[model samples]
Target: MTQPSPLSDRRVVLAVAVLCCFLWGSAVPALKIGYGVFGIVPSDTATLLLFAGVRFSLAGALLLGYALATGKPVGLDRRTLGRVSLLGLVSTAGQYLFYYVGLAHSTGVKTSITTSSSTFFSAILAHWLYTNDKLTGRRLVGCLLGFAGVVAVNLSGAGLDLAFSVLGEGFILIAALLFSLGGIYGKRVSGQLDVMVMTGWQLGLGGLMLAVAGLATGGHLGGFGWEGVLLLAYLAALSSAAFALWALLLKHNPVGSVAIFNCLIPVFGVSLSGLVLGESFLEWKNLVALALVSVGIWLATARKDSVVGRPSP
Candidate 1:
């Protein structure tokens, strides 16, 4: 029997990347439901921070617990700890702070589309940061196609609009940039530390910072019932699983190769939002968007000539 290829195998990498994006996509609807259950309003910045803080803190704890339980070494040197803390601050806390605030100011459709810009940011940054991941015609086209699909989906109910606000669309774009930068930095850090351990520590430290900030700003969670607790736990679990898997993928593959899958997050978000919240999902544009995204992924990842950032077997 042919043995299964390692996780870094192109096929395996693609599968895991898609899975990670799917989990992240689910978070859109889940967060909306969470806001309702927790009695959070779009204007409640403090409460939003608190909710995000608690979810990430718990996610970090769970990841750390899993690493220890699975016999993975959990040791972190001082430098590593500092690096992880920075990663957490920028990646988890800062990104979400901007995202929540941005979402509050902007429409959901706009937020979804703008946040997808992280794929382009990641691709551009990787080209500058890593020699092997230089920008190529295929990668550029793939990214453009994926971005077009994102725009297409958002155009279903509302046609394209040029309405812009600094705090609204601008912050979302900033969050996307921070997220992309953090991913690149994390890729560099992963060369030295265990990806799981790194993810756990960064999340823990970042979540703690967010918690402190939220509390200082008088953030409060209204619902403390079983439903609230269950939703919180689910969000935490999703973060743990998605981040850990993503870290692993970044460690093994080119940044652009892995980051392209992020296009699917918006696609999945729209579909899941429809299913969970009973929103309309039958638009022809949705189908076209998904098709474009699929083609984009294929074009970006199917190149055998491109140099993957990982060391050769």
Candidate 2:
């Protein structure tokens, strides 16, 4: 019999999930700053891949080391190794391949808004994949409301740009879809695996694939300094922490219930990106967006009679 996770508690879920969102949200600005520090131009696809690859590789190493140091089981059988490797490919490597490239071509605000669509994707997938997690009217409304906030963030100034680019917003949407699918798979696999070990292996294997791809395609990264190294370390640290925590949450909760918190990422991303990257964020729409997303979160998670953490009958 599987022991219940303390993370399944609603309050703990809310707190830790929000913490994950905050960490992920801060990644927007951090990544952009990393680009500058490493002297990666927008056109440098190979180097971009290399940079992302290295960050995840280090993150994976950190998690694996921590898992071992803490006396957690780190050994995997062939079947489990295959599963974790696939997860690494889909969740980390595949998603970030598009994400890193997409971010290079789009503004942080725009990228954040677009990627927020992953919430909806996860919700839709969970609706089909899990009986207990069927998409209810309340959940739909909550998702829409949260998504409305995502839209409102860009409505300020000249309003949202209607322009779409294959390499920009298009790639971001693809990444979102990949991430949603990966979440479902991760949830399924975590049922029998230690969340920490699973997350670490996936990150390490996926990151290694990315690094190899970047190198094979002639991606080279240079311009290393103390600042650059430190920034890279921070990115790695944040990924290690946030991803490990998120995997634990998914191990205990419904995908929709947990994924709804992704709406908060853009809220944090826009605000942080504006402050850190010198983009405009002090618009009236931002406050309205925040309110809508907050209500959406409450509606999604605060069900009085919800059996959210249970598996389907």
Off by over 4 Å in 1: 1-5, 305-313
**True-structure lDDT of candidate 2:** 0.87
lDDT of 2 by residue, 209-278 (tens): 9999899989988878999889989999999999999988887788888888999888888899999989
Error of 2 at 148 (Å): 1.0
- The TM-score values for the models, in the order shown, are 0.95, 0.93
TM-score of 2: 0.93
Off by over 4 Å in 2: 1-3, 104-109, 277-279, 304-313
List pairs with backbone clashes in candidate 2.
none
lDDT at residue 224 of model 1 (Cα atoms): 79
Q: Give me the displacement of residue 4 in model 2, in angstroms.
A: 4.0
Give the Cα-based TM-score of candidate 1 against the true structure: 0.95
Per-residue CA lDDT of candidate 1, range 1-313, in tens? 5443266688888789888888988998898899999899878988899889999999999999999999999888788888998999899999999988898899888898899999999999888777678678899889889998999889944587679999999999999999998998898898888888899988888898888888999999888799889989998999999998998888767898888899999889889889999999889999999999999988888875332374322
